[model samples]
Target: MTSMKRVLKLCLGSARGAMVQGGALTVLVLLAGVGLLALSGWFITAAAAAGLAGAGLAFEVFRPSAGVRALALGRTGARYGERLLTHDATLKALVAVRLRLLRGLMSQPLRRLERARAGAALNRLIADVDALDGVTLRLFLPAVAGALTLLVSVIGLAVLVSGTVALWIGAVYGIGALGIGLRFGPQALPVARRAERALQAVRARTNDAFAARADLTVYNALDRQIAHAGHAATELAKARAHRDGIERAAQFWVTATVQLAVAGALGLGFMAVTNGALSAPLAMTGVLAALALSEALMPLARGISEFGRIADSARRVMGDIPETVPELHPRHDAKPMVVPPLDLRSVAIRPLIDTLSLTVEAGEMALLAGPSGVGKTTVLNVIAGLLPPDRGKVCIGGTPLTDHAEEDLRGRLGFVPQRTTVMDGTLMDSLRLGNATLTEAEAWHLLDIVQMAGFAKSRDGLQTRLGSRGNALSGGERRRVALARAIAGRPPVLLMDEPTEGLDEATATAVLKGIRAYLPKSAILIASHRACDRVLATRVITLR
Candidate 1:
């Protein structure tokens, strides 16, 4: 499919639930609008005909009063329905887009996402999605409805009065509004793109300033940072202003051209009446109908302008989502291996900066001792399927790690990084990651296993709330909670980084003891500089 089709498909897929309601409402609104316009023309025609017949035009004189009233009611009802459906669909689409973005981020490596400007992603998710409201809700349905309404109104005018004059008015209005509006599509899209970029830059700069607020305050550079933020905001405002200006200019030209076309049609209509080709009442009705028909183009003009903005914003956001990730596939269709325990064979780890090789057999507890700059964590990442090897294979039970799907590989291992990232939730919520179906007893059991039972008991047990990033808990508590979660899953392979860092000697010893208790059943690989002779691994690899 083409790129535009693909983007639209993605949007529809996300908001499929809402699209049902929106589509129904859109149909109703269009019907109502058409009815209202037709009733309006009838009112004008009836009033003109009554006056020519020498009877004072009265509301009771119109034969189709009931139809007019129904049309008016339909217009009101359809407007409400359209608003309800459009809002529902737009919100649903936004949610779907948000979920897709999150999934994309998860599939990509942290390094790649980090390399992108933080503000750009945020702007796409927030502002860009907001911009799409008009496109999905207003642009497609209204433009189509307006075109059809214009056509029918023009045809009705031609049948009632001068056909040539009606045709001329229709052509001018259609070309000036729909055609000229389309011409501005390309011009306005770039402005929307620029606006999106500028907004992202502003968000990124503000985020950076907030993240470094402490440092900025200490260094007395807060004012400088604030000034920089103002500059970014100004840039975004300027881009938005330019886009709005272009849209306004396009709208004005369309309105002016349509009005001029109506005047010309009226002139032709007057001559036709004077020459006895058409009745005075018919001529008056023709002029009034032409003006009404021409007005339908207004929505088309506005929709085209708004569509350009929506399409541009959607493109920007969709483009930012990562499209590629390294895939791992074994050379052969290897059978799944069932061995006594976890094992790594011919495992070579190559980080962005360095490379290393190692192997660990089942029932072995190994500690990877190295300086801060070494490829210690990189080695663990390879085992966890987070990173791909440069030239070697990671195997478990003689089965290449790459041979297994990512979900299967993940099921076989447990990982705890140096900086524990605690989600915003209760303590039990974090522990539930190990096993979503874990029972209350099982949760407390794992907390006991990690020597965190006392900590949980001290608080409100598993019900204790944790702040965002676990700010409510200390670094040591966060590490223990993460460790408890990793071990709770009871995977056969455990990879830990600085599990004992920042903990007191007594707490560190207790945490190490708990980890050692699981070493007999699981192959444990830890990266740390501190030596624990009591829980020492059977083998240790020291890297420079």
Candidate 2:
């Protein structure tokens, strides 16, 4: 019903097969351990009783000893196998989760993305996804294994001893231990979730303090910021302590129930032995069984406490994710065509542009000039289909933009904006964003067109690794690099938004010349406020 439930259910379905395998191994491990302990108790007790009665020589010890040894080995092997299987399955599930999250984000509407609070949403995407990684490993597998352990233990006791004894053991373990664990589990959900959030808050504060240390020192608030971060950490610690305290208490209650079950079995076994309904060796076996089962059941409390945290993680990770949209698959069958002319019909975007229509044909350059905040960039975005028009439509090559999938259409479009953001990677990596398979020679040629050939050649060339945000390059160089990337694919529609905003007149002129020379036949639309940009345009459109 809820986002958390939906996400958890989806993940469970995906990982169910692996979960079953791991759970089966876990159940084997627990059963073997309990069986070994019970057999050892019975054999030792029987041997002592027989020796005192002068029948030690006739008592069989070899078979029971071999059985104990076999069970011990089996338990050890199953425990190891369980760890390996569960961890591998969990890792595979996490990979699936990340892929699904990426697809979800890609398919989300741009408008919705814009509306989300950037920092909080981004934090949830990273942290919450990581938190959900433990769901399959810790909660689901353990709970299932615990259930299997209870079922097998109860059934065995019924056959070996009495139905009354089996019911007693089951009621104590199932109704007492497991019931208490489950009852207290939901209470920890809110507290544990709050603690997790508080921890995130502390981390965020610490990062902020480190990132802005210099600014804080300059403004004489460095100590204050540090103190604030310390306060956040303290709050996080308190929340964690409270959640852990609740978990500890639940564990105590479950442990007490287990002890009670063991005591009950021992007392009942004594009475049955006295009445000749049960043997002394068999009585010892039942007591040992209860003891071993306690070991298996106590962890149920921990698993129950973890349920809240996992549920919270699922909710956060999947809650904000928008509904899936139609995926844009590559159309390999579609033949490549010439770049189409860009057209806008009855385009009205609020107070910025009203009833505006324009077309930029091949080999033509259109300049859009307006004062600041006039939505020049918005117009470029609309035409690029990054944003849809409030009214009217945009067409390229006589096809409405809506008719083509975003991924399929974007391959044929080249866009360069005012601020160039280059990733921290090699020069080739940056250029490859436009065309992944572009050769080194073609990359060099594009760089030359943008006047970066000499600079790149003298340095590491295409292999040069740039600093964060491409800060290693000058403002002009970064812009040129972005321009080269945009033109690398030689797309039909080229949209430039304030290309020469932060450049000198000479640099801006060279940049415009590079564009015209590189993409001579592409339908180019440049939104700029500079008069020099208008001069290079074959036609200029002005907005008041």
Candidate 3:
């Protein structure tokens, strides 16, 4: 319950600004609706009492046009206000939720994150966060506003008319609408969950297919893969159809029940008029007021049904994120570390499933050479502060890496993983990931060192766009570009995994030479299996 409350609070905090605006608009609309209904009842009663005489006929002529204009203005204003506030809140909440997810992932160990698929993480970030947009804006606020409107309107109408009449009207409208929501709410949950799962599966499968497009084409299995995607999409549509059908059935029953209750009220009003207990105009007015009051509850019922679906999706999304990320805590008396430049005292890291310990010193380029699956990249991640050792202490400049601020520690080291993760941007944008303030001259100079100057020269220098995953450039060129990015910041320490994997002999040598020239003072650690590459290292630390 406490966790749920915390999540709600986080969501509300993001949307509070828009809630204020929406709440105000909701109040105005409720007032306008009540006023319109009351005034229309009074005017109709007056016209009936006058028996269509001269003044009565004139009153009827002006009242309807006046009511229509006022109602139109109120509805238009309310809708505009509601839309403005809801959209603003939706966007704000999405941003907050995304940031929270990112912060959570950042705190976890690299190996744990790797265990979670990339597509799953991406789905959580994009689709899961998007789920909350409807939750807060379309579902929560509107439902709350509608309920308030019904309550206030019912109380006001009771004061204007008989308590019994108001009670009958409120009960018929409110209970019917509430019943509709309750009946379909539970059924909607399964459908929503299945739909969300299907969407995630589709996303993951699509990503896998695209990543292995060449393999699929070579094996002539492209048609089969496409058919699989079609099936997933079909499943999603079926789930949606099922949920909608249930909701529609609920709405149908609720509407029928409300209509029967309204018919009963009108019959009672007519009998009262004939018996002289109520006037003819009063009877007609009472019937109209009851119908209008009942209609107002429809939006509330729809909002509740939508909210149920959002809640279901929210549960699934939150469950997908690992609950292990530590909450941020502030320190009062702790000062930043100020000591030796870099220090690693007997640091030993062994994988949870393996038995090996690797250690290195500052200002030394140690190459971890071993067969595949020996956790070479994992070892580098541990050293680069991207992963925490299971049973070892990681200290830099005499302070534990965990104790130091994450941003400060990250600034002290550079890491380029085996898989190239390039954002959708120009070459300069990619380079800026290393150091945002890297000057144009310095960028070109670094490119020259990596033998990429000619490529940049052929293009339009820093403005040249690089395709996704560095697809625009050759394999060796991509490796060099990544290398240049790693050393751009000239951090105190550098960690590289398979740095020369795709480079040709000449380009490989040039990349090695560039690392030596640019990072002459920084501690460089490269993990590779190439014997020729080991010759460029200051010291080789081989792993089994």
> How much lDDT does each candidate structure score?
0.71, 0.81, 0.71
For every candidate in turn, the CA RMSD to the true structure comes to 4.1, 2.7, 3.3
Per-candidate TM equals 0.85, 0.91, 0.89
Name the best candidate (by TM-score). 2
Give residue 129's lDDT in candidate 3 (0 to 100): 68
Count of steric clashes across candidates, in order: 0, 0, 0
lDDT per residue as tens, model 2, 1-544: 1765566566666677776788899899888978988899999999999999999999998999999989998999998988887777776776667667767775566667767755666666677777776676666666677778878988998898766677787888888855776578778788777878777777777778888999999999989888888887888788778777877888888878879888999999999999999999988888888888876777766766666777787877775555453445865654444467999999998867777899999989999988888888889888888777889989888778877656768888888976678889989999999999999999988887777889888899899887888989888788888988898888889999988877778768887888788888899999998988888899999877
Candidate 3 lDDT for residue 496: 85
lDDT of 3 by residue, 221-285 (tens): 98888888878988989887877777677677767766865686578677777778776665655
Q: What is the per-residue lDDT of model 1 for residues 1-544, given as tens digits with 9 covering 90 to 100?
A: 1334545566677777666566666555554554555556656676767777777535455456677778778767867876786687677777766666666666777557658765566666777767766656556546655676667666766776678877887788777865676677777777766766666667777888898999999999988988988987888898778877776877787778767876887788779978889766566666655666544566655665566567777666566554442343432455663542445554555443344556665666788887787778777776777777776667776677767655556656789987678888988999888768878998887787667889889989999988888999888889888998887767778889988888877777777776668546777788888766225668888877
Q: After superposition, how far is residue 378 of candidate 1 from its true place, in Å?
A: 1.0
Which residue ranges in model 2 land beyond 4 Å of their true spot? 13-16, 115-119, 323-325, 331-338, 471-476
Q: State in Å the error of residue 300, model 2.
A: 3.1
